[model samples]
Target chain A: EAGVAQSPRYKIIEKRQSVAFWCNPISGHATLYWYQQILGQGPKLLIQFQNNGVVDDSQLPKDRFSAERLKGVDSTLKIQPAKLEDSAVYLCASSLGQRVFTDTQYFGPGTRLTVL
Target chain B: GQQVMQIPQYQHVQEGEDFTTYCNSSTTLSNIQWYKQRPGGHPVFLIQLVKSGEVKKQKRLTFQFGEAKKNSSLHITATQTTDVGTYFCAGADTNAGKSTFGDGTTLTVKP
Candidate 1:
């Protein structure tokens, strides 16, 4: 079985520039999530998707951030006009279902975004 | 929003020393999980505890769920350089199985 896969392990951009990251989850996984981890901080959930529908995104910064899993197998998170504070590791994870207590999660190497 | 916290945000241990990190939540949790992230890596699932006061061990790592179900702990025995990383504990409450991860405890081992 393959593990979660993400593109562009590292990215560098200036403030106000747009950036995007992509992820391909493990096969047969039904749930996907996007999180942002700042330096010295735990990951903060940005959005979650169940199949092709969103399960939770209340914490997402809608004004500047957007994500979509059109076919439910892959996902893309975009940030428009990025900020210096947005420089962090963008992590993507997937599980078989919402029952994380019973289902294990697999993570990718994450995209380290650096905003100048 | 739920409040989940972890203690000893940072710890330094010499080789062969034991260390532990604690997790606490304001609300009762249905289950708790542990994850470890090595330097410059993403979190990888370690284990989950559902039953109250449950204890599980993996090699030198031991995880315990509190009797109150709102707290948990992870103990590592005889630390090694390979044990260096940030450990995060997350709670999956009865509400929807959604989890809130606590700020991780970064462990540094002196070899």
Candidate 2:
């Protein structure tokens, strides 16, 4: 059973630059999520997708952040004109379905974005 | 907006000592799950509690869900160096599919 996979374990960019992170969830998983974890803080949910459709993205910064899961298996989260405040880890997680209470989520290694 | 809080933010203990962390929520939670993340690693699921006042144990780790379903605790006995990590508690809303995670409690074991 392979775990969730993410690309570019670490990234560094200047303020106002753009950055993107990719995530490939566990096999057969039906739900995917993107979270932002600032240092010393818990991971904050940015967006959630059930298959190719978005389930929730209320916390996403519409002006700067966007994410998509075109095939329902892989996802990409992008931040344009990134700010210093966006310096945090981008974590990707997956679960079997929306009934998460009955399912456990598997997380990827995460991409640490450092905005200077 | 829902919030789940965990404390104390950090703790250090001798290898043979015991440790515990608490999680509280502003609203009643339908279910709660726990995860542990080692330094520089991703969070791994530990356990889940659904019914109010449920208690589960795995080896030296004991998890308890409050009778009110708004609070929970994780207790570790005779901690070892391998137990060093941050433990997080996530609470799921009764009406929503997403879960809100707490800041987490970092535990350091002195070997």
Candidate 3:
């Protein structure tokens, strides 16, 4: 059983530039999530997907951030016109999509984005 | 909006000392999960508590869910250098799908 995998362990971009991050979740997992973890803060849920359909994205910045899980196995999160404030770690997590009692999320090594 | 708060953002102790971190939620939680993230590493699931006043132990680590189901605590006994990391508590709402995580408590052990 392989763990969740993410690409580009680290990234650096200038303000107003665009950046994208990719994630491949664990096999057979049905729930995928993207979270933003600012330094010294907890990871904030940006979006959640269940089988290629979005379950929740209320916290996502519609104006600048977007994410998609086209085939339900992999996901990509993009930020256009990135701002310096967007510098944070992007963490991708996957779960079995069970009830809260049994749903334990496994996280991937996050992509640390540094916007200058 | 729901909020989970953790106290004592940071703790430093000797290798033989014990340490504890507390998590409190603004609303009742149906279940709570704990994760540990070492420096420069991703969060790994530690444990989950569902029933009220449930207690579970793993080696030297102990987790407890409050009787009110709105608070939780993680206690580590005789901490070692390997115990250094940030511990986070996430509370799952009645909806069963949504969860909110606390800022986390970072523990540092000095040998």
Candidate 4:
């Protein structure tokens, strides 16, 4: 089976520019997550979706960042008026979405964004 | 808020040497999961520990969870060059309904 897929493996933009990324999780997976990983650091969760509903997004910067999983299988993360700190790799992962929360996540290759 | 910390930000060892990384959480974790990320690659899940004091082994790697479920450790025996990568521990808090990841320990195996 194919793994999670992401578009535009890499992107470069100037500070204050807007950017968007797309993700397509594996078939049959019901839970999806978006993470931001800065160089040399672990991934930080930005948002999570259980099917079409938002499960958690407390860490997301609502003022400039937003994500949505409209149909429950694909997702999009956007950053408006980006900052230099926003230059990082965006990763998307998915799991079986068990009610009890015990599932191994599968990750995509991720999109590396560079903001000048 | 829950915070996960990893020790020895980085490690470099000759092949056949042993290596260990520690993970500690400010609050008790419902479960802890380990992941490995190669340079320029995304993280891939390696294992998960759900029960307190649980110990699991895979080949030359051994994973241990603290009895209090607030800490965990990963040990690599006789490391090989293939083991070079960043290892991260993620602690899940059911009450918070989220998982927090440690900064990660980058391992370099000199062949």
Candidate 5:
């Protein structure tokens, strides 16, 4: 079986510019997540979706960041008026369900974003 | 908010030597999962521990969950070049599968 897939493996933009990242999770995986991983740091959860509904998004920066999982299988994360600090890798992961331990998130080769 | 601290931040090991990384969580975790990321690759799940004071081993890699469920450890015996990468320990937040990853420990193996 194929793993979670993400597009635009890399992205470069200037501060104040808008950028978006796309992800396609594994088939039948009902749980999807978006995370931001700065260089030399761990991935931080930005948002989570169960099927088409959002389960959590407390960490999201509503000011300039937004994400959506329209059909539930694929999702997109966007950043508008990007800041220098927003230069980081955007990662997408998927799991079988919301159960702790039973749900092992499978990550994709994140989209590395660099804002100048 | 939950936070996981990984020790050593970075480790350089000679091939055939042993390597170990520790992770501590600020809050009790229902479970802990480990992942490894190659220099330019994505994070791959290594293992998960759900029981308190649990120890699981896969070949030379041994993972341990603390009895208090707030700490964990990963030990790699006789490390090799293939073990080069960053090891991360993530705690499953109370929000279920939502995981908060630790600042990974980058391991460099000198051949």
Candidate 6:
């Protein structure tokens, strides 16, 4: 089976510029997630989607960040007016369901964003 | 809010040495998982523990979940250069309906 796929493995943008990252999850997976991982820090959940419906996005910066999982297979995460602190790796993962205890997650290579 | 913390942010040992990393949670976790990320790579799932005091092993790696469900540990035996990476623990709280990841423990093996 193919693994999760992400586009533009790396990106560089200036502060206040807008950037978007795209992800295509493994086929047949029902849960998709977007996470932001800062250097020397663990991944922070930005948003989660279950079959096109958002399951959680409490940590998402509503004012600057937004994500969508249209058709429930692929996802896109966008950040407008990017800040220097927003320079981090954005990872995309997918699982069969919300059963984190039982389901194994497949992660993408991730898009490393550098905001100058 | 739930928080997961891993101890020994970094560890360096000889190839024949044993290394261990611990993870603690502010709240009881319904389950805990382990992931490994090599430098410049994304995390890959290692294993998941659900039952209290559960212990699982994979080759030279051993994972244990505390009986209290608030702590966990990963131990590696006779570390090799291939074992160099950051190990992360992610805890899931059923009530919170989410999982939290620890900062991770980076391990280095010196041959």
Over B1-111, each residue of candidate 3 has an lDDT whose tens digit, in order, gives 789999989999999999999999998999999999999999999999999999999999999999999999999999999999999999988754569999999999999
| Candidate 3 lDDT tens digits, A1-116 | 99999989999999999999999999999999999999999999999999899989999999999999998899999999999999999999999887534699999999999999
Q: Give model 1's docking category.
A: medium
Q: Score residue B37 of candidate 6 by CA lDDT.
A: 98
Tens-place lDDT digits, model 6, residues A1-116? 99999988999999999999999999999999999999999999999899999999999999999999999999999999899999999999999985644688889999999999
| lDDT tens per residue, model 1, B12-72 | 9999999999999988999888999999888999999999999999999999999999999
User: For model 5, what is the alpha-carbon lDDT of residue B108?
Assistant: 100
Docking class of 6: high
Once fitted onto the true fold, the runs of candidate 2 whose alpha carbons sit more than 4 angstroms away are none
lDDT of 4 by residue, A1-116 (tens): 99999988999999999999999999999999999999988999999999999989999999999999987889999999899999999999999898535788899999999999
Q: Give per-residue CA lDDT, model 2, range B1-111, as digits (tens).
A: 789999999999999999999999988999999999999999999999999999999999999999999999999999999999999999998675558999999999999
Between candidates 2 and 5, name the one with more favorable TM-score.
2
Q: Pick the DockQ winner.
A: 6
Report DockQ per prediction, comma-separated.
Answer: 0.74, 0.80, 0.77, 0.80, 0.74, 0.83
Q: By DockQ thresholds, what CAPRI class is model 4?
A: high
Off by over 4 Å in 4: none
TM-scores, one per candidate: 0.97, 0.98, 0.98, 0.98, 0.96, 0.98
Residue B26, candidate 4: C-alpha displacement in angstroms = 0.3
Model 1 stretches astray by more than 4 angstroms: A98-101
Model 5 - which docking category?
Answer: medium
Candidate closer to the true structure by lDDT (higher is better), 4 or 5: 4
